[model samples]
Target: METLRLQTFMVFMLSSCGFVLSFQINHLLYTQSNPTAPQTLDRNDASSILNSNFDSSLPVKFIIHGYRESGNSEWALKMKDELLVHAPMNVIVVDWQDGSSGWYFTCSANTAQVGEDTHLLISHLQTQTGLSLNNVHLIGFSLGAQVAGNTGKRNPSIARISGLDPAGPDFSGKGASDRLDPTDAQFVDVLHTDGEPLWQGGFGYYEPCGHVDFYPNGGTRQPGCGLVGEICHHMRAPAYYTESINSDCPFTAYPCTLGQESCSTCNGNCGFMGFHADKSQANEVFYVETNSESPYCRG
Candidate 1:
């Protein structure tokens, strides 16, 4: 029976989702501080996969990668490091580098199954570690953001989810069930750093979809990003989030009043964004500006 289950796991890992494509989907999963030594969990081995503790009392953070990137990417590792420095918690990175490569549309289409399969993987881990679902936080970047959204859909009891500039390509203008929306979890916060309309080289969703949607620097073109390469603008979302993890100054946001969606002004009470954010200020839009370099917090 054990051998049969292992064979089944292998078949699932090497098969494509549902786009008439069949290629090996290797998931280089990491549940440790070091990315160089990631354990492939699909082999049905859990006792030896992680050398750390998954305390049920503490929160679990899953940091996912974006297009053409893997768990070994700088952003993934940087965020993991920052989180560990801030708190002693469980951090896992989902590496779908094999499935997320190739054509853009193909990769976009693969997120649906990725979310489903990842949810199953997390569920399996929970059973082993006796972890609570309420203590899980999903922080997904770009396409991974959408995957996190779908994961929330798969398991609706998650405490909170942070969509770091969810990819706008196949998800924009989609319904709440189709893309990242407020109902996906108990609290959902989104950061928009590259919301330029799709017609204008935008890499992120332009609309406010989360409970608290933060638009830093007008949420269009970032301050230091070049005029031509929009990737830098999109990448700023995770950078700012990483800095917010351990910075002396937090990323505070100003509320936007009625009919003031695009206003660069601040009104009413303000709240901090990212890891230290308050969930009480949900269903609102926030705006803030940052410096051109490290310690981007203006305050």
Candidate 2:
């Protein structure tokens, strides 16, 4: 009888150890396999593909693309790569089913669809990543800027929204203007490239934020293009993403070359000669250059 009792106790101990090991293995796999780990969205079929190993404490950065652009744009990818220098935070590129076209120049139900889809994505982020209002930041370019602006205004979860050279033309006027202001967002900053595109309303028309208008490289056509009549669309990334706009601007003359120098003016005829949005705000506008200059209009 003593031998039998001892045998029973040994079996129980071995079984308990095995059970504990199995439970731990299962938990690890569950967290690893599921992308949106903590809170999985029932709607998206591929939400499980996201890495569940996200930092809960760090802020979440959302990058929204333009109308016809994808999350895989060269600039978007580069920014994501550079931003990784700051760890702990997770960067998610939002790709909505927006109709293909000029991208910067389009407005319809399809446009609204992009905004709606973005909100849904944000909601999903909140659930899975455990991000709160102050923990979210948005960066949008052109129409993407408008999309970010509208979404930030509507969604309280967003902390700050940065509009990189908002697309002009279609998004001008009074009623249309009210939707894209800095005040509408928790904190908004509008950077205009073709500030007052002649086709739209000329320079310095839209004023969403009474303060905080930032201009990079004179806020006009991008640098490097030599005497080109067209506006600088390619200049968006270099203008904002670079170390400073002043040095980069001269390089991107209208007829861009290896070494070119052009006077910085807004005549729209000179190479790299372009003027964009107004920096009339009281806040010291950051030309986004390494040099420290007052953020106001200069000749």
lDDT of each: 0.77, 0.45
lDDT per residue (tens digit) for residues 118-224 in model 2:
56666765677665767776667766666676676567446667676664445666464334566544556555554544333222223433235544444554444
lDDT of 2 at 196: 41
TM-score of 1: 0.85
Top lDDT hit: 1
lDDT of 2 at 139: 68
Candidate 1 lDDT, tens digit per residue, 1-299?
A: 54554455334233454443544433444334543465455526666434344455667788888877888889988898888777767677888787676666778777887788778877876777777888889999999999888888998788888999898877887899989888878889999888876545677887898989888887877888866224788998999999999888977788874324454545556888777777888888888778887778986
Model 1 clashing residue pairs (backbone) = none
Off by over 4 Å in 2: 1-51, 102-109, 176-178, 198-211, 227-234, 237-239, 242-299
Least accurate 10 contiguous residues by lDDT in model 2: 21-30
Off by over 4 Å in 1: 1-36, 48-53, 257-268
**What is the number of backbone collisions in each predicted candidate, taken in the order shown?**
0, 19
- TM-scores for all candidates? 0.85, 0.60
